[model samples]
Each structure stands twice: as C-alpha cells, then as structure tokens.
Target: MKTYQTSHIRNIVLMGSSKSGKTTLAETMLYEGKVIDRRGTVEAKTTVSDNTEVEQMYQRSIYSTPLYTEFMDHKLNFVDTPGSDDFVGGMISAFRVASTCVMLVNAQHGVEVGTEIFGRHAADYKRPMIFGVNQLDAEKANWENTIDSLRQSFGKRVALVQFPVNPGVGFDSFVDVLMMKMYKFVDENGTREEYDIPAELMDQALELQASLMEVAAESEEALMEKYFDVGELTREEMIRGLYLGFQQGILNPVFCLSAKKDIGVKRLMEFIINVAPAPSARLEVLPDESTLECNADGPTVLFVYKTALEQHLGEVSYFKVMSGKLTEGQDLVNPETGAKERISAIYAVAGKKREKVSEMMAGDIGCTVKLKTVKTNQTLCAPGVEYVLQPIVFPQAKFRTAIKAVNEKDEEKLGDALNKYSAEDPTITVQYAKELKQTILCGQGEHHINILKWHLNNVHKIDVELYAPRISYRETITKVACADYRHKKQSGGAGQFGEVHLLIEPFVEGAPQNNRFKVDGKEMVLNIKGKEEYTMDWGGKLEFYNCIVGGSIDARFMPAILKGIMEKMEEGPLTGSYARDIRVYVYDGKMHPVDSNEISFKLASRNAFKEAFRNAGPKIMEPVYSVEIMVPSDNMGDVMSDLQNRRAMIEGMSSQKGFEILKARVPLAELYKYSTTLSSLTSGRATFTMEFLEYAQVPSDVQEKLLKAYQEEEKED
Candidate 1:
C-alpha cells in the first residue's frame, strides 16, 4: 500500500434505501480498483459492507462499513451505509466524515422512502451528491422513469452524465454523455469495450450533455461567459466547472450502473477520482467562527465517527483526519474526556479485513484499536494545540420497550451488554425509568431494538425479554381536605406519642393565599404561613408550610413531618404512584417531650397526609408526546384517523415534498408498538418522530383501570 496526499484522497459515502445495490456497488468498486479479486453479492452474504452476523442473517446492512480503494493514483474511501431508517445512525455517521455522498436509487423501484429520507440527510449535511441509478440489469428496470423521478424529486439540478443504452435483462452498455462515448461491459468479469455512441440515441445524449453543460456553466462566471460566447465548453473546462458545481451542490450528476453485472461501474469510479472534491478542497467550519483547511503539516486533529467491536480486535474506532496527518504510535489527547491515548497501530479497513498502514494523511479514514478513552464523536488532537470537532447529532429514539434479563442473575450482564451496544451506536439508548420501575431500551424502531436483543443473546450470551414499558403515571390532588392522626405506642419503658393536624390542598404557582372550606356547615379559613417549596428530584414539587401558632408544635419537628409527608408522597395513597403538585399545611400538632421523637412525628404525619390525600380529589396523570408523522398524501386520512382513535389531539398539518405532515399529541400508553402499526398501515412508507411534551391527567376510565390493577398487584404481592 502507498500513502496518498490529502489532495489525492476522495472520501465518499454510499447511501440509499435497502436492497438498492449500495453494497453491490461497493463490491464492484473494490473489484474495479483491484483491492479485491472478486465481487460478492448480498444474497450469498459475502459482501464486504454487510459483514455483521445480524446483517448476514437479515441479508441487509446494519452498520456502516469503511472500505478504501486506489483508483488512478488516488485513494477513494467509501463508507457503505445502511439504507433502512432503523439504522440511520450509520448513515448519519458516514455523512459526518465524508466529503461526497453517492446516493444510489433502485431503477426498478425508482425513488423510494429511503431515497427521500437520505436525500434530506445529505442536504442537511450539505455534502455534494452524485446519483447512481443502479440495477439496470434487473428485469423491470426503467431508466427513463427513474431519471424523471429523480429530476422531479430533487429539482432540475439533477443532470444526466450517463444513461443506459439498452436497460433490461441483457443490460450491458450505457452512453456517457460527457465523454460522448459508449461503454459496453463484455462480460461479468468487468471487462469494458468502448465504442462511439449509436446514431439513433445521439440526439438524446446530446440534449443531456447540453443540460450538464448548462449546470456546469451556471456554476462559474468564467464558464458562463465562455458558454455564452462559444455556445459550448471544452472537455477540460466542463470538467473543472462541473467539479466546482458538484462541490457547491448546484449540480447532482446522475450515472447509470448495473452493479451486479459490473456495467458502468468503472466509469463511475473514474468520475469519482476525476471530479469528486478532495478533503483539502472541502471547507471546514470551526467553532471560533473561522474556517480550518485540511493541511498535512498542521497540528494533528482527528474526529472519531464510528466505533465497533470485533471478535478479536476489541474496540475498533474509525476516524477521519480533519486537519493534520495521523501516524502509528502517535499520542493524542481526547478533548472530550481530557484523556491521553497512544495509537499503537493504524489500519486501512476494508469490511472485515484490515491492512496495517504506518500513517494516514489528512482527510483519510482509518481505524485504531484499543483506544481506552476515545469513543465515537470524540476529537483527538495534539495535546498542546487542543481543538474539538463538532460531533454528529443522531436522531432521537422513537420506539422503546422494557427489557429484563430472563434470569435475574444476568441483570448485570444485560446492563454491560447494553452499554457496549449503545457505545457503538449512539441512537440506541438504555435508561432506567425509576418512576416506571423498569429498564427501558429505546431505538429508532422495532427492528433496531430486535437487533440489539439479538446481539445481547448471541454475542453477549445474555438472554433478555422485552415488554411494553409501563406508563409513569403521576398522582395529584384537586381540592382541599383536612385530617388529623395521633401516633400512640407504649411498647416498652418509653412511650411513643405524637399528634398531627394537617390540611392538604392543590398547589398553584403563585403567592400562597388562605384556603377556605365548609366543614359541617361551618366556614373554616386556613391561613398558610411560611410556605416552603421543595422541587422533587424526579419531577413536580412538594409544597409544605408550618402554620403552627401558640406553640402548637415545635418548629424543629416540622422538617421531620415534611420528610414523612414526602415518603407518603413517593407512594401515593390513591394508587401508589408518586404524588406531586400538592401543598401540606401543618397548622397544629401535639408532642410529648419524652416520647415524641422523629419516628413518632413521621408516623403521625404520614398517617394524616394519607387520610387527607384520599379525601381530596386525587387524579392520575400520564406522559404525553408531541408526534410529527410524515406520510404520502393518499394515506393521510388513514393515519389521521388512527391517531384520533388513539385519543390524539390534532395540533397542526402541513405539506413537505409531496408528503403530508401531521402533528399531534398522543399519550405514551397509546403508542406502544405504534411504530410497527404505522409501518403496516402505510406499507412501511410513512415515518414519524416524537418527543416528550408534558404530563396530563389520564382519562377517568383509564385511571379506574390503572388503580384497580395496582390494587390487585398489591394484594398479590
């Protein structure tokens, strides 16, 4: 292997929907570059990109795999990403480090949900895009419709650089509009035979060529002036202008390919090496409102974009040199953790195989094993000249489930396994929901969680079960009620005696006022004094006050009473849920100097608070989420109706790129397995995202059922 300069390196990411030939295209690219002797297919589970056991079992990609090949004296680093939205974390990671994105579209299916989703992701990253209309050899391949769909979905900036001359079962050749030549694949061995474009399709090819020229010319003043004067651009001028246009996202050149049959792949490789922007050419925005250029002589700075665990390799961290060169045995400090790490070995990774490299130049992607403190999204730089790169922002987890080890002894193992998986993929989150009393595992969708479970069972040997998570319902009071209790115990020599007279009322956020109540046809006015509000560590607040007068109770005992009340609030009287947003007023109490201790006061306060809470209007509150669903226009009615059935309130509606967007608020209880249901209803075309909004009171019927269930569980326990 030879080391390449930053100017000769091309960092590209292959992105598209699943089964869209991204892996196949990657395999073909490796073969064409002589990095691999043979091409592997997805069906055989031998492709470099989809090498993981989960991916091999499912016959799809689950993680992004980095593979490099040298073409035309340039190093082309290809990050092959998963097409499924369930593993969108991989795609986002790839986009973060890559300078260009080659978005592959299935010719048979044309533009799909994955294509649209990743197109938006590429736009979000502002990465230059090149469209590859793949699977030209498929039986139902439609080149015209696919190109038209691409143009319609992505605007007129999509200009054709190549087109299949005969796209069908025997698809072997495509006309290159820019070169004005026909490239024919003689066989499956990737042997190419060049010829002049056929006379019949010359007009169409010339028209596409003109479109490409117009896009290229409009990107530069010199090119535009030359085009207006001479009505055309020379081949060198066109390539230069198109390269600039591509980097600016003003031109998205579409290339035709049959990755399986090895048709037009070599041409695409040539285009990448010739036209794609090098790492030094791409501008990097810095945190100090300045731009950092990729310079090999500058201070060392690398951004870790992906992390994975191999069978014998421990933890392999893949990173891109953002500013300076990285060499083996170099010491760098992780700015995130302020920990120093020494790179023992550097390897250029190609799927599961790795080639040890002494050094990697700036803008090159490589991996180092066993960095104790370095993790994904961590920036490693020289110790003295410290700088942190922007980390990749992953999407929020949409689907969640309560997970527990089948055998209680393996609970600790389960936690360790989950931590490892979450470290590799940040989109997968594991959290202990104390209020719900369950360990919740959250991911992009059901498939994502299932893969994590598979890893847990097969990789870590920890068997676990996933169930619907419990809703964290809250308990609150609506009205005011007063109760008194006396704790009297004469078990031994010393007696325990304490009496508490407390009034419980609904808490409001403003100034405390007198609470009026009618007791037995008598008006009773209770004045709040010295109110103290303590915010609960979990959520909500506990309001307490000492309205004691005339030495009714010692001031020191008020803290003990409040503590007792909080203990009872932790397990509310209504249904054992945490109580919140309630004020407790201890107006009077009696204490014996010898017997009345903290225990007696606590017991009396707990009993009195429980009695008053039950008498007051207690209600259960459930968590609500704000959901935004994107679906095709035809399925909007069905989706809206389904949301309404879930007791969701339709907040707003809008349109985006031929899709209908529905915004609503729905209770978390109603959203169990909703991702699976939404897929079934919309044929896996609709996508949605949600975030926690606020807690609202549960319906009366739901509250009744929950209370009954809790009571029954308590009895059984």
Candidate 2:
C-alpha cells in the first residue's frame, strides 16, 4: 500500500439509526472505489463493515469497523459504526477519531432517536457532517417530509445538495443543485447519464440553490460580501465557502441516496473526497495548552481509538496518526502507562482484512498487531516527548446483572474472558459488588450484554447465567440512645475484663436552631495516633468524644475501641449492610491493665455499639437515582404513571423538540429491568439515562421484607 499525505486523506465516520443503510453505503463506496469486487447487503450478511459473527447473527453492526477506499486520488478512511444505541460506545469512539461524520437518515422513518443521539454527539465533538437521506427507493419513502423533519430536528443549517426526482420504487435519478444538472442512473452498475434539470422543477431547484449559496456565504466575510454584491456565487467560490462552512459547523450538506440500488453513491463519494475537511484542517490543543497542526513531519503522536481480538492474531490495535508519520517499525511510548511499544506492522484495514503498509501518514487510520501495552484511548508519542491526547469518555453502564459460571471450574475463566471483552469495549464494565456478594456485569442495555453472553458461549466455550443484581442497601440511625456492656470472661490462663458506656445518636451537621435533640456538647477534634482526625468523612461519622475525665479508658485503647465500632458498622446489627451517619461517645469505661487489652476492649465496644444501635430507631436506606426520560408527548402520561407506580418522585418536567423530558428520583431496586419495560411501553421510541443520587430511607413495607429475607438467609447459613 502507498502512503498518502495528510492533505489527501479524509477520515470520516458513518453513523445513524439502525437499518439506515450505513453498512450498505459502506459496501457501495468500497465497490465504487474498486477496493471490493462487488457490493454486499446487510440481509445477505456480506457487508464488509458488519463482519463479526455476532453482527452477522443479528444482521446488525455490533462493533465499529474501519475500511479504506481510494477515491479521486484521495485516501478515504471510513469507520462504519453501529446504529443501535446499545453500541453507542462504538459510535463515540469513531467520532473521537474522525474529522467528519456522515449521518444517514432513513427516508421512510425520518429522524429517529438514534439520529438525534448521533447528531447531538456530532455537535458535542464539533464534527462537520453531511446528512445522507438513504433508502430513497423504499416503498414508503417520503422525501419532502423527511427533509422537513431534518430541518425541524436539526436546524436551518441543513442545506440540500441533491433532490430525488422519482423517489420510491423507481428512484434512479436526482437533481444535483450545485451543478444544476440531473444525474440519472441508467444501469445497476452505477452508470449515470447527466442532463439538464427538468423545466417543471427548475424554479424549486433555483430557490434551494439560493438557500445553499447563503449558507456557504456565511462561512467567510469575503464570500458574504461577494454574494451580497452580485446576488450569486461562482461554482469555485461556492465549493470553497461550503468547505469553510462545514469546518466551522455552520453548514450541514444534505444528499439523497439509494445505497442498495447504487444510486447517487458515486457522487456522494466524490463530494466527500472533494468537500470534507482533512485532518490537518482541524486544530488540536496540546498538553501545554498550545495548538498544533496535523503535520506529517512533526513529532510522532498516535491515538488508539479502537481495539479488537482477532481469531488467529492476539490483539489488533487501531489508531490514527495524530501527528507526524508512523512507520512500520517505529517505537512509541504510551504516556498513560509509561510503557514503550514497538510497532510490528502497519496495515490498511478493510473490515477484518489487512493490507500491509510500510507507513501511515498523519490523519490516516491504520491497525497494528500485537502491541502488548497499547490499549484503546491511549496516546502513543515519541519517547520522551510527553504528549498526551484527550481520551474518549464512554457513557456509564445503565443495565447490570449478576453473572456466574455454570461450572465452578469456569469461574476464573469467566472472569478472564469478561476482562478481555471489557478491554475491547469500554462500555462493558465488570465489577465485584462486595457488599452484595455478586459479580456484576454492566452495559448499555440487555442487548449489549446478550451479545457478550453469546461471545462467551460460542467463542470461549463458557456457559454462564445472568440474574438481577442485588441492591446495595445501607443502615443508619434516626434517633439517639445510650447503652453499656462489659466483657468479663475468665479462662484461667487469661481473663478478658472490660466495660464500655457509650451514647449513640444520629449525626446531622447544621442542625436547626430550635431542634431539642441537638447535642449541647462542645465539638472536640482528636488526632488519632496513625489515622487522620475524625471529620465525618462518610456522609456521617462515628464522632467519638474522649469524655474519660477519670482516665477510665486509655487514649491508646480508644483507637482500638473505634476500630471495633467500625467492624460492627461494616455489618450492621439489624442487617448485614454497611452502616453510616452516627455519633459515638465513650463517656466512661473500666479497664484492667493485664486483662483489658485491645481485644477485650474491642469486644466490649462492639457489644455496646450493637446494643445501642438496636435501641435507636435504625432505618434501612436505598440508593436513589436521578433519571431523565425522553419520550414522545403521546406517551407522556403512560410513562409518568409508570414512574409514579415505581414510587418515583417526579422532580421536574419540560419539553424538548417533540419529546417530553421527565426528571425523577427512583430507587435502584425498581429500575432493575426498567429499560426493557420502557422499550415495550413506548415501542422502543423513548430513551432514558440515570445517575446515582443520595440514599433515602426505604418504605416501611420494603424495610420489613428486606429484614425478613436477611433473617431467613442467616438462618439457612
């Protein structure tokens, strides 16, 4: 393979809703560029972009695939991303590395939830986009309504570059407004016959062209002035203006395409090669707050955007040369781990196929095999250069499940496999919930996890079961109480004798002025021997006051007593849950020099603390999450009522675009399979996101049920 200069390389990512023809469009581009012998379709599972077994099984892309095509003497590196929200991490990773985004919209469905999400992400990344309204040949295609929906959902920045002439069924021709000509596809092989626009559509075409010219003019002051002076723009001037407008994110060019029928695809590729912004055109900020241009001769800097595990090959690391040229044998240092890695071989990737290349220029995406230390989102720079690029931030996992291997011997293998998968896709997280005693696997949704399960069973030969995750409940006190206990045991060889008098109460900072339960004692700060001073670190604290006026308990032993109290807090008296937010005061205690060692005093302190906790009004607290749900207005009432049934406290509500935004706080227990339920309720049109808020007391009935279950488990043990 030949190395292309940065200026002649266009790194673009294709993203949109599912079944929007992204994979088909990618196949068409490859075929048009002669990289592939023939175009493939998603239905046949022969598309280059969706090459994985899991993808082929689902007939949808489950991961991002990188492919390259040489069009118009320019190297175009396209990262085809999954359109499902379950694999949004792949889309995010693609956007992080690409200079431009080509968002496909299903003409039959118009702008969908996936489109809205990808559009927002593109804006967030400041990626210039060209909207491709695909599937124009579908039976229910509505070109006019789709264009209007695009204008309304996105903005007026959407400028039409092409309009389908005979859309739906026999969609073969489109009017190219920029060239003032009609491109008629005469054959299935993408052979087009060009001619003048029809007389009937000339006025509409002229009006749209004028709008396009205005959008292009707004890109630069000189173009704006020239357009105002002449009320028109030359073809060359319009192209330049459009490129600038695209780089500035002030314009979104729209094109019509029937990717399956190979209509207008070649023209779309031509436009991408000619108009899309090159990597060098996008400025990047350096570590020292300095800006640097993408230069092939600058210091070597590469950004690892994706990683995959090939069947024969150990690991394949996909990266883009952010600066300078990356040679096949070049050695670079990972700034994150400070480990050096030697680039063994560079390849121009087309799906799973690899074409060995001697070097990759800046702005070109390539893959290198067997990098031990390199991982996704890691920056590889020249040794001692100390340059670090910003890493991609993946969304937090929303759905969680407790996973266990079917065979006990496969537990270790299951963990290892899960880690490998997690490393490949950061969206899947594996964690051990110590308090819940469950190994949790979290991901975007059920489908995302199901794919991993399939990989585990088919690829790794491991069978596992997934169940609902246990909620992490907590215990805390609501009132004040006092108790005393004495440990007096004599074993002839040694004796344990200690007494503890402690007062336990709920610790609430900034108590009301009129509150009668507020302690009238002076706040005392004590510096322990080997630990930091007590500062109420965990939302509440075990505020211990050394009220030992008569030296009943030694200062050194007080630390041991606090340790015992913490041990008891780890497994609360009422239930085996972590305790928090309580104050303890050791007013008086009896200790023998020989018998009252750390162990004896610890036992006494623990007993006294448990007794006091039982007397105090202990309550069980459950984690609450702040949820933001977006649904169409028609389903607002149903969603709202469902939330209310789950004991959600509706915080606020608002309207965005055509969707209703409902904000609420709901317990984590009620949200175990909420995503699945929400999908069923809204026909998969609604979306939601949640994050952990503060913990609140559980309802009395829920508390009773939980306590009973805990007791039964204890009895069984």
Candidate 3:
C-alpha cells in the first residue's frame, strides 16, 4: 500500500439513527471504489461495516467500524457508527478522530430523533457536516418533507447540492444543482450518464442552482464580490466557494442517495473527495492545551481512539497518526503510561479485512495488533517526545443495575468479563458499591446493558441476573434523646462490666456547640474536656465530646468508645444505613478496674449509641438526582405526568427546535428503569440525563416501610 500525504487523506464518520442505511451506504462506497467486488446487504449480515456476530444478530452496528477506500487517488477513511443512543460511545469516539461527519437521514422518516441527537453532537464537536438523505427508493419516501425538516432544524445552512428526481419506488436519478446536470443511473450497479437539464425540469433546477450559488458565495469574500459583479459563478469558482463554506461549518450540503440500489453512491464519494476538509485543514488540540499541526516531517505521534479483542488476533488497537509518519517495527512510548510499545505491524482496516501496510503518514487511520500497554484515548509518541492527545469525554451513565452471576463460583469470572467489556466500550462501567454490598453496572440505557448481557450469556458462557440496585440511603436524627446501656458478662478467669450514659443530639453546620442540655425535664450541664470532629467517608460528620467529670471514664479508653460508636454510624441503627450529622457526649459511664478492657467499653458504647439513636427522632434519607429531559412538544405533558408519578419535583421547562426541555429533581430510587419508561412513553423519541443532587429526608410513610423491611430482613438473617 502507498502512504498518502495529509492533503490526500479524508477522514469522515457515518452517523444517523438506526435503519438509516449507513452500513449499506458504506458497502456501496467500498464497491464503487473497487475495494470490494460485490455489495453486501445488511439483512444478509455480510456488510463490511457490521461484521461482528453480535451486530449480525441484531442487524445493527454496535461498535464503530473503521473502513478505508482508495477513491480518485486519495485514501478515504470513514467510521460507521451505531445510531442508537444506547451505543452513543461509538459515535462520540468517531467524532473525536474524524474531521467530517456524513449525517444520514432516512428519507421516509425525514428528521428523526436520532438525526436531531447526532446533529447536536456534531455541532457540539464543531465538525463539518454533510447531510445524506438515504433510502430514496423506499415506498414512503418524501423528499419535500425531508428538505423542509432539514431547513427547520438547520435553518439556511441546509444547502441543496442534489435533490432526488423520482424520490419514491423506481427512483434512479437525481439533478446536481452545483454541476447543473442530471445524473441518470441505468442499472443497480452505479452506471451513470450525465445529461443536460431536461426542458420539463429546467425551471426548478435553475432556481435551486441559483440558491446554491448564493449560499456558496457567502462563504468567501472574493467569491461574494465576483458573484455580485457577474451575478453568477463558474463551476470551478462555485466548487471553491462550497468547499470553503463547508469547511468553515457555515453551510451543510445535502446530497441524495439510494444506498440499496447504489444510486448516487459514487457521486457522494466524489463530492467528499472534492469538498471535504483535508486532514491538515485544522490544528489538532493536545491534552496540554497545545495544538499540533499535521506534518509528515514532524515527530511521529499516534492517538488510539479504539481497542478491541478479535477472535484470532489478540487485540487490535486503532489509531490516527497525529504527526509525522509511523512505520512498521517503529518503537514509541506511551506518554500517559510511560511504557514503550513497538509498532510491529500496520494494516489498513476494512471491518474484518485488514490489508498490510508498511507505513502510514500523518492524518492516516490504521491499526496495529499486540501492543503491551496501549488503550483507548492514549497517545504514543517518539522516544524523546512526551506528548498526549486530548481524550474523548464520554457521557455519564444514566441506567444502573446490580449484576450477579447465577453460580457463586463464577463471580470472579463475571467480574473479568465485565472488565473486558468495559475496556472495549467505556460506557459500560462497573463498580462495587460497598454500602449496598452489590456490584453495580451502569450504562446509557437498558438496551446497552442487555447487549452486554447477551455477550456474557452467549460468548462468555456466564449466566447472570440483573436486578434493581439498592439505594445508598442515609440515616440521621431529627430531635435529641438519651439512653444508657450496661454490658456485664461473667466468664471463666476474667469478667466484663461496663456502663455508658451518653447524650445524643442532632449536629447542624454553623450551629454553636452546646455543653448544656435538658433531658426528661431535667437540666444537666457537661464539662468539656476534649472534643474531636471527624468527617465521615459517606457524607456528613461525626462530632464526639468527652465530658466525663472527675475521671468518670478513663481518657485512654475514649478512642475505643468512639470506635464502638463508629461501627453503629456506618451501619445505622434505624435501617442499617450510614448515619451522619450527629453529636455524642459521653457525659457519664461506669467501668470495672479488671473488666474495663477495650472490648467491654466498645460493646457498652455500641449499645448505648444504638439505643440513643432509636430514642431520638430517627429519619431515613434517600438520594435525589437532578434530571433533565428532552422530548417533543407533543409528548411533554405525558412525560411530565409520568415524572410526577415518580415523586419528581419539576424545576423548569422550555422549548428549543421543536423539542421541549424539562428539568426535575427525582429520587434515585424512583429512577430505576426511567430511561426505558421515557422511551416507551415517547415512542423512543425522548432523551434525558441525570446527576446526583443532594440527600433529602424521605416521607414518613416511606420511612415506615423501609424500617419494616429492614426489620424483616434482620429477622430472616
């Protein structure tokens, strides 16, 4: 294979909603470039982009598949990304490496939720976008509605470079306004012939061409001046103007496509090769806030955006050359890990097919196998150069559940499998929630987790169950109370005798410490000897005061007493939850000289704290999350109503681009499977994000139920 310069390399990503024909279009593009002899359909499970078995079973692209085609003496590398938001990680990773986005829109559905979501992502990343209206041959295809939807979503930026002539079934041709010619496809094999605009369609073609020229002219000062002087632009000048506008993100050109029939596939590739931004068009930002120019002469630097474990190949790490050239057998150091890795072999990837390439230049995308310590988002540079590239920031996981293997023996195996899956896809996160004593798995939505489960059940041969995760509730007291506990045990040789009288009170931030308290209608004052404050690991603080007057309790035993109280605080007495924000004053206690060991004092203090906590106004607190939801205006009311049923406190609501934005604070306990519910309510047209807000007290009824449930669990144990 030949090494292409940065100017000759075009990196693009195919993005759209599911069933938009992105994979089909990719197959057609590969066929048109002569990289493949025949086109493969998605239903046949033979498309290059959806090559994985899981993808074949689901008939959808789950992971981002990188493919390259040599077209017009240039290397065109594009990533086929999953359309479902459940697998948005793939799309986001592609966004980081690709400079241009080919956003496919299913003509039959017009602008869909996936289209809107992906469009927003492209805008956020500031990537140049070109719209491809695919599935033009579908029976329900509507070109006019699709165009209107595009205009509504993107405003005047929707520049029409091509429009389908006969959009429904039997669609075989389209008029290119920029070229001022009609391209007719005679067969399904992409055989095309250019003809002058027919008289019947001359007026419509001229009108669209004039609009296209004006949009292009606005992109450059020189082009605008020429257009104003001559009232028109030549073909070459128009192409230059369009290129500038597209690169600057000022205009998004629209093209027509019937990917299933190979119609307009060749034309789309040609336009991309002609107009898409070159690899060197913009400077790449580094992790240190520095920019690096794509130069084949500079020191070699490669950034790995993806890593996967193939069947035969141990591991394949895909990367883009950020600077200079990378040759096979070259040694580079991973700046983040400080580990050296030798690039043993390089291959141009076409899904499962890998073509050996001896060298790759800057801005070229390729893969290498058998790297010792290289992961996604890590950069490998020449020996002396320690430079790291900016990492892709993935969205926070919204759906969470506790996962456990059916057989206890496979627990470790299940953990290993989860780790591997998480490594391949960062969105799948796993963590052991110590408080809940359960291993929690979090991802974008239910479907995302189901896919991982499918892999575990089928591939790893691990049977697992997913259940609702327990909430990390907190325990606190509302009012002050007091109790005393005495622990006495007579054993052989030695005896245990200890009595504790402690005053419990709620701790409030910025509140003055109190040395006087009234308990049971009696006023009691304490002499403060020492006070210790500790910030609890969970949330609040524990304040302990030693007010033992006249050596009532030994100072040396204070730590042991505090330790006893700590155990109770960790496992709250109310519902075995973590207790926080309380003060304990050991005002008085009794200890035997021979039996007053740490164990005796610890046991005595533990019981004393538990009794006092129960006597006090014990309250259970649950975690609340601030949730923001985006849904269509028509479904806003239903979404809000559903949220209300989950005990959500609506914060705000607004409108944007035909969608309604709703904000609320909902308890995490109520958010179980909320993503699934929202999708069902809105017919999969709604999206949402959730974040931890603050812990708040649960209602009295909820507190009763939790207390009863905990009591039942304790009895069963």
Give the residue spans of candidate 3 off by over 4 A.
509-531
Top-TM-score candidate index:
3
- What digit string (tens of lDDT, one per residue) describes model 2 on residues 65-111? 89999888898999888988888898889887788999999999999
Worst 10 residues of 2 by lDDT: 524-533
lDDT of 1: 0.88
lDDT of 1 by residue, 438-526 (tens): 99999999999988888888988988999989888889988888899999998988899889999888887784566676644667766
Question: If ranked by lDDT, best first, what sequence of candidates would result?
Answer: 3, 1, 2
lDDT of 2 at 389: 76
Candidate with more favorable, higher lDDT: 2 or 3? 3
Ranked by TM-score, the better of candidates 1 and 3 is: 3
- The window of 10 residues in a row where model 1 has the poorest summed lDDT is 511-520
What does candidate 1 score on TM?
0.95
Assess the local accuracy of residue 669 in candidate 1 as a C-alpha lDDT between 0 and 100: 93
Question: What is the Cα-based lDDT of residue 410 in candidate 2?
Answer: 100
